[model samples]
Target: MARISTKSLTNRASWLVLRRNRIMTIGETVGILRDNDDFLVVTHIRPDGDTIGSASALCYALRKIGKTAYLYNNPQFGDSYPWLAEPYLAPEGFEPKYTVCVDMADKGLYPEGFKGSADLCIDHHPSNSLYAKNTLLWPHKASCGEIVMELVKELCGLDAEVSELLYVAVSTDTGCFVYGNTTGETLNAASELCFAGARNAFLNKILFRTSSKARLALEAQILSSFLYYHDGKTVISVVTKEMLEKAGANEKDCQDIAALPGRAEGAFTSVTIKEIDENSCKISFRTNGLVDANKVCAMFGGGGHKMASGCTIKMNSFKAADTLADIIGEEYK
Candidate 1:
C-alpha cells in the first residue's frame, strides 16, 4: 500500500462538524485521490444505485488515468444494474493495496468479515461514522455520486460511462429528483452528466417507471396494511415474511418501498418495516423535511441520510413496527 503523506497535500487537513463526524472539503479529498494509485473499492451490503454507481465511476476514472482499481463482486448486486456493475468485479483472491468504501457510512453495512478496514470512505450520509482513516464526506450533498462526479472531473474528466454511472448514483438516491434532498447543486450535477452523454431517458424508464408484478402485489399488500398516527403525519407500512411469500415477491420487489407512503397527501413521516425473518426486521424511515429520519433510526441503532435512513431491529416484526412508530410519534411531539 502507498503511504499517505500530509506533506503531499496542498491544503492542511481542514475539518468541519457534520452530525458528529468531521468532514473534508472536496479539494482535500481530491488531493488524496491524486496521490494514490492502487485501489480496491467496496460498497455497502445491499448495494444501492449510489454505492454501485459511485464505485463504478471511481474505478473507471482511475483506470482512465492508468491506475489500478477494482470493485468487489458483491452477491447482492442484482440484474437491474449490469451495465454499471458487471465490468468491475475484482477477480477472486485479488489482493488490494488500499480498501476504499463508497456511499457507505456505517461499519454495520460493511461486507461480511471485512470490518474496520476502510482506508478511505466517501459518503453523503449525515450520520456517517468516521470509520475510515481518511473520510471524504459531505453530508449536505444530496448524493455521494455528486461528490464522486466532481472528483472524477478533477482527476480524469468524465466519459460517457462514468457519467451514466454517476447519473445512476445521483438520480436513484434523490428519488429521481423528486425527494426533499434534491438541491440546486444536485440538479446541476445531473445536467452535467446528461451533457456528458448519460442516457437520462433510458435510465429514468428502467429505474423509476418500471416494476415487476411481484413488486406491485407487494405494494398492494403494504397499502392494505398501512396505518397513520399523529393525525396522519406519521405513516407506517409493513412487509412481513408471510406477505412476501404470499405475494411471490423477491428482495428486488421491496426496492424503494419505504418511500411509498410518504407520497400520500398528509404524511409528514413514513416508516417501512420489512421482516427479513421471524425474529429480525429492518426499518426504513422517510420524512418530508419535518423530522430527522437519521435521529429516529439512531434510536434503534441505525443511521443514514436525513430524509432517508434505516435501522435493523432484533424483535418480531409486529413488535418492531409498533416500537418504531411509537418512537417516531414521540419524536414528532
Candidate 2:
C-alpha cells in the first residue's frame, strides 16, 4: 500500500501518452460513433455494476443512432445479476464486424466462449493490455460508467435509460459514494442522471434484496467465522467447501459476505477466502487505506484496482491462506 513515487507517476504517464485514446474526450468519441454503424458490446466474465451499466448504456445509445449492436458475456454473469434487464443478447449465428469491450482491458477476462479481438475498449483499469484497435484507459476516471456518461452527453444527450444505467455504474464502483474514488465530476454526472429520472429506490430494492434461503444461511455462517489480529487491526474469514455445503451456499452467496471484515476496528484490510472448488479459491480484498490488494492479486495472476481488488489462488485452502497472509504482511513491512 505504499504510495506510488514520483518516478512511478512519470512512468505511468509516459505509458499513457504512447497509447492514449483521443476519443476519451466526449467530443471525439461521439464523432467516431456517429460515423460507425455496427458494434458488439462485451464485458468481463463476472460482470459488475460498471460492466452492466457501461454495456447497456453504450449499446442503447448505439441503437438510438440506428446502428445494430449485440451483447454477450459468460452465463454465470446472468446468475449473479438477476436484477439487471439482461441487456446482453446473442442469437445463434449472430455476428458483428466490430466488438466493443466495456470496463475491461483484456479479452481473456471474458471466459472461454468469448475470445477474440475487439474493435474498441472503454475501460478505466490500468492492467488493460490495449487489446483493441481503439482504446480508452483512464485510471483517473472513477468508473467505466463515467466514461460512458461523457459519451452519452456528447452523442445524444441524457435520456431516462441512460440516466438509470449510468447511476448503477457510478454508485456501485464508488461503493455508494463512500470509497476514495468519488470526485466532483462523478457527483455532477450522478446529479444529471437523477434529473433524468433515475430512481434510487427501485435500484436498491432489486440489488440488495435477498430472496434465497441459502443466502440467509450463508450470511449467518459468515457472521460467526470471523478471525481478528493486531488488536483487531486485521479481520479475516474463510468459506471452505464444507462450510459452503453445510450452509447450502453457492458462489453467488459468497459475494456479499466477502467485505464484512473491514468493519472491524483498527483494521486496514478485510480478507475473504471462498473455496471455488477443492483445489482453487477466490479471494476478495478490501482495504480502508494503504493496503494495495492489487499487488496481492497480481501475485496470483489476477489484477484490479488498489483498494478493492480480487485474486484467485490455484493452491489448496491452507496454502492459499499462507500466500495471502505473506503478501499482506509484505505491505506492512
Candidate 3:
C-alpha cells in the first residue's frame, strides 16, 4: 500500500482531481478499503455513541481484514462511553497512511485541533460538507452505523463485537428506535445485526434504561426552564452554566438533554440552548414534523436531518433561547 504524496504543485492538482472523481459508491469505498492499510479513523467533536460506535466498528472491521487501523484520540472523548473506544485509540506519534472519518458531517465537526483532511468519509448526514478525498454518504440511512455495517459486511463478515458496536451506533442516533428519523430500513438493519449476535437487550439496558442522578437533575432543570411560545407549539429550554453547576452535571451527564423539551405534549418545535460561555451558546433543535429542524438550525449556519439539527449562537443562553423561540414562532404565522 503506497501512500499518495502531495509534495509538489502537480501532485496537489492531481490529488484534487482524484478526490473529485472519488465521490464513491459503496463498491468503490470497499475497493479503497481493500487496497489501503494503516488507517486512522476519526470521530466527530462531542463524541456520541453514533460516532464512537461507527469509528470503533470500522477499526475492528479493518483490522479483521488484516489492515492496520486505529482510532484518532478525540479530545472531547470523555468517559461517557467508557472502554468502548479505548482499545482502538491511536498511540502517540503513530502516523496513518489513510485517514477515515465516520459519522462526521463536516470538517468543522472534526475533533478539536485535528489537522489535514480525511482520505475517506462514511456518513449518513444530509448536510455532509464532502470534506474528505473520498466519501460514501447515505443521507437516507438512519445512522452512519448502517453504512458502516454494509462496508463491514463487504470487507469482512460482521463478528459479535462489530455487531454490538454497530448496534450502539444505530440505536443511539435513532433514540432507541423512538425518534421520527427511524425507518423500516433502520429496523431491518438492526434486526440483521441482532442475528449476527449483537446483544440488543443488554445494550438497550445500558444505553437507554440507565441514567445517572446528575442526568436526572439536569433534566429537571431543563424542564423547569422551558419557555413556550406560539401557543405551546414552540418551546425553548435554556441550560446555563449555573444550571449545570446547580445540577452537579457535566457534559457527560448532559447527553441527549435536548430531547427533554421535545417530550412536552404540545410542543411541535423544541430548542435546547446550552451556555458554552457568556457570549456563546450551543443549540440543539428537534421537531415533530411540523417544522424543519435542519432549516431552523441553518438560520445560524448549522444543519443536520429534518427531525434533529443543531447550531451555535453567538449569544448568551437566555438570548439564544429567546431568539430561537422568535424564529420558530414566526414559522407558525
Candidate 4:
C-alpha cells in the first residue's frame, strides 16, 4: 500500500469537511441537542464501551431534558454494559425524527443496514470523516465520553447514572487512565464524574481489575504465539475463530485484547488481527508514541486516533498479519 503524505491527508480531510459537515463547538452542539426531539442515537458497529457509554449517556441526558430519545438497537451490542443501554433502546416500529451518532468516526462504522447520514456527530477521533451534517469533534480529548460529559452538563446537569455512564466511556477509551491518550482533562472529567457518583471502585473492579477465566486462557494463547518484528518494537497477535471456541471466550472476553501485545517490554506498536472469517479479518493497531497507528490503519481504509486505530482487511488472518507487519515494518525502517 502507498503511504499518504501529511499534506495529502490534510487535504483529503479538508475536502470531506467542506463537502458536507459543519464543525461545531461544544456549546453549539449543546444548543442543537436542546433544540432537537425524538432523537435516535446510533453507535458504531461492534460497539465498545466508549461508543455505547457515550451514546447511552447522551440518550439519557436527552431524556432528562424532557426530550424523547432512544438508542438505535445495535445488533452487535453485547451484554457488556446492558444497564447503561437497555433502557434507552429504540423499540420496534419506532420512528426517529433526528439521528445522532456518538463516537463514530466515519460512515463505514455505521451499523449494518443503517440508512442516511447522521444529523449530528460527537466524537474525539482525529481521523473522523465528518460524515454527519453537524459535528462536535474534540480530537484532543481522550474519549468521546468526555465530549458527551460536557454536553450532558450543559443539557441537564450530570446525575449519578449519567456520570457513571460517562465515566465508563472515558475510562475504557483511555484504558482506565493507563493508555497514552489519557490527559489532564481526561483525569479531571473522571474526577468530576466520580464526585457525581460514578462508582469507580465497582467499575474499576469489573472493567479493569478482573478478567474472566476465558480471557486469561485467550491471553495465554496469544502470549505464546506473539509475532515480533523490527527487533521486537512491533508485536502482532492473531486470534483465530478456533481460539475463541477453544478458550470458551466470546466477543466480550476479547475486548481490549489488542493491548496485550503492547505490554511487552520492548514493543512500541502492537497489532491484533482477529479472524472474522475465511475471507476477512479485523485489525486493531495500538502504538506508544512511535509509529502512527492511525496512518497505518488508514492505508487499509481505516482510521482513528494516533495511538489506536483499526481496520478490516479482506484477507485471511495470517495473510492480513503479514500485510500489516510489512506496512508497520516500513514505518520503523
Candidate 5:
C-alpha cells in the first residue's frame, strides 16, 4: 500500500464531511436507531475503553428512546470495562434489526465467527476500511466517543451514564487528553460531559492514578525486558505469557502496557510485543510525533492513529520484537 499524504488525508476527511448525503449523519443515525426496534452494537475484538464506551453509550441512548438495544458479546469485555458492558450483553441468538459496529475500522477487528455485515460503522480512524453499508467516520475527531456525544446530544440523552461513558471513551483514546491527537474540540467535548455529570476526578483516579499489584508486577517484568536500539532512539519491550503468569496478571492487568516503552527518555519510536502463543505475538508501535506509527503497523496489514498502531505477527515473540524494532528504525532512518 502507498503512504497517504497529510494533504490527501485531510481532503478525504473534508469530502466525507461535505458529502453528508452519502455518509450518514448523527440525525440520520438517530433516525435509524429510532426506526429499528432491535439493535445490537458490536465492539472490536480486543475491547478498549473507546469501543466499549461508544457502544455502551449508544445502547443506553437507544434504550432511553424506548428502543430495544443490546451490546454484542465480546469475550474481552470483562477484561477492560466490565461495569459499562455487564448490563448490556445481547441475549443468545438475539436477532437484531440493526447491527451497528462502533469504533471498529476494519471488519477483521470484529470478533471471530461474526459473519454478518454491519448496517452502519461509526469510527474516528483515518484508515477506516469503509466496510459497512453506511459509515459515519470523522477522522479529525480524537475519539469515536466524541462522535457518540454528538449522537447523544441529538437524541437528548446526555445523562450521567452517557456522560461518563463518553468520558472514558475520549480520555482513554487521547491518553487523558495529553496525546498529540487531543484538540480544542476534544477538550471542549470532555468539558461538556463533565458538566453533564461525568465524574472526571473520580474517573481520572481509577483509570490513570491507580494500579493493581498484579499490574505493577507485570509492568516491572516488562520493564526488565526492555531493549534499546538506534542509540536509544528506538525501544522494544516484551511480555510473554509466562511473564504474565509469573506476575499473576491477565489481559485485564496489561492495560496501557504498549505505551510503556515509548515513555523512555530520548525514545523516538517504541514497540511492545506480547506473546499470544508460542508461534505468534501482537505488536504495538508508538511514535513521538515524527514517525507515523500507522505506517509502521501498515507494513503488517494493520493501522491506527499516526502515533499509535498495532498488528499481529505469526512469529516467535523474540523474533517479532527484533523485526518490529528494525522496521520502525528503518522507517525513520
Candidate 6:
C-alpha cells in the first residue's frame, strides 16, 4: 500500500536476477546459528549420496567447531554403509534444540515417525515450499552441498574435513561431473575440495564399487519380472514379498534397481512397485523428458521433480499399477 523502502526493493530485484542462488542474507544466517549451538541433522528419505554427503558433512563441521551435532539413524541403510553410520552419527539420547534437514525440500520427504521442529531447510530444489522457519535455499546450485560449502566457508570457515565431505556431496549430485547440470562453478568448487584433501578414488570405490550378493540376486529378479506396457511406451516392474525374501533382498536393493526400467528405449515412463506390506505398496516412478511423472505421482498424493517422483499405494499392487497407468496415460496422450 505505502511506498516500499528503496533498499528493500533493490535487494529483491538483485535476488530475482541471481535466481537459484537466492540464499538467506548473511545477517539472517548468522542470526539462525546464534539461536542454537546444538543441532541434529537429517536428510530426505531413501537417502542418496548427495543427501547423505550434505547431512554428514555438516555434522562433521559442527563437531569440529565444538558444537553438538547428530545424524538420524538409518536402520535400513544398515551395516552395509558402516563408513556412513560412524561419522558424526546422531547420539541416541541427545535431544537437541533444533533439527536441520539437509537437501530436503519438503518435510514429507523425511522418514516416517521422525518428530521434531524443523529449524532449517537447506536445498536447491526449485519445488521447495520453504517449510522450515529458517531456510537457506540455492535452487540454482548443482547440489545441496554446494550451498553447504558456502555456509561453512562464510560461517565457520572451511577446512580439509569439510571439503572432503562436501566433495562427496557435490560429486554424487553431478553424477561424477557427467550430468548436464555440471557447470564452471561446480568444477571450481570440486577443484578446491581436492586441494583440501578429498580423495576421489577411495570415496568412489566405497560409493560406486560395492554390491552385496543379495543386491546381485535382486538384479536378476528385476530382470526376470521386467515388463513393457503401452506398446513399450511404459515400463513396469513388480517386486513381490516372496521375490525379495528368496533373493535375501531388502528395501535398499529394490530402490537401487528402481531406475533401470526407465532407461529402456522407447519407454516414456517407468513404474516399479514393491510390496510394502499385505495391502500397501511403495511405488517409484521415473520418466523420459517427454513425460512428467510428477503430475501422475501427485494425483496419488506424491510429488517430485518433473521426470521423477513416487507415491505410496494403499490398494493391492495390481490395482495400484492400473490406477497409476490411467493417470500417466492421460498426460502422455
Best of the candidates, TM-score: 4
Quantify all predictions' global Cα lDDT against the true fold: 0.83, 0.73, 0.87, 0.88, 0.86, 0.73
How many clashing residue pairs are found in candidate 1? Answer: 0
Over 4 Å off, model 3: 1-21
Per-residue lDDT tens digits for candidate 2, residues 71-170, read 7755766546634536647576777777788898666677448866777778887666665767766767778898888887777788887888888888
lDDT of 3 by residue, 1-333 (tens): 123345632656667754573567888899999999999999998999999999999999999989999999987788458477999999999999999999988899988878958899999888886678888888889899999999999999888889999999999999999888899999999999999999999999999889889888888877877898888888888889898898898888988888788888898888888889999999988998778889888888999998899999898788787788777777767
Off by over 4 Å in 4: 1-19
By summed lDDT, which 10 consecutive residues of candidate 5 come out lowest?
Answer: 1-10
Inter-residue clash pairs, candidate 2? none
lDDT of 6 at 283: 84
Best by lDDT: 4
What ranking of all candidate models by TM-score puts the best one first?
4, 3, 5, 1, 2, 6
* lDDT of candidate 5 over 1-333, digit per residue (tens): 122334554566655543442357677777876777898899999899999999999988888888899998887887898898988999998988889999998899997557678888999887787778778888889899999999988886698878999999999998898777889999999999999999999999999889889999999888877899889998899889999999999889988888788788998888899999999989888887678888878888999889888888899999987887777667776
TM-score of each: 0.90, 0.87, 0.92, 0.94, 0.91, 0.80
| Candidate scoring better on TM-score of 3 and 5 | 3
RMSD of each: 5.2, 4.1, 5.3, 3.9, 4.3, 5.7
Pairing residues by index, what is the TM-score of model 1? 0.90
Per residue, candidate 6 scores C-alpha lDDT tens digits across 87-168 of 7777678788878888887788885557875778888775665577667777667788888887777667767777778888
Model 1 lDDT tens row, 1-333: 132344544454323222233345677777777678778899888878889999999999888888889988777887337568889888878788888899998777886555448778898887776777777877889999999998899888987888999999999999999989999999999999999999999999999999999988888888888877888888888788888899898887777887788877799888888888889988888998678888888877998877889899899888887787788777776
Local error of candidate 1 at 228, Å? 1.7
lDDT of 1: 0.83
* lDDT value, candidate 2, whole model: 0.73
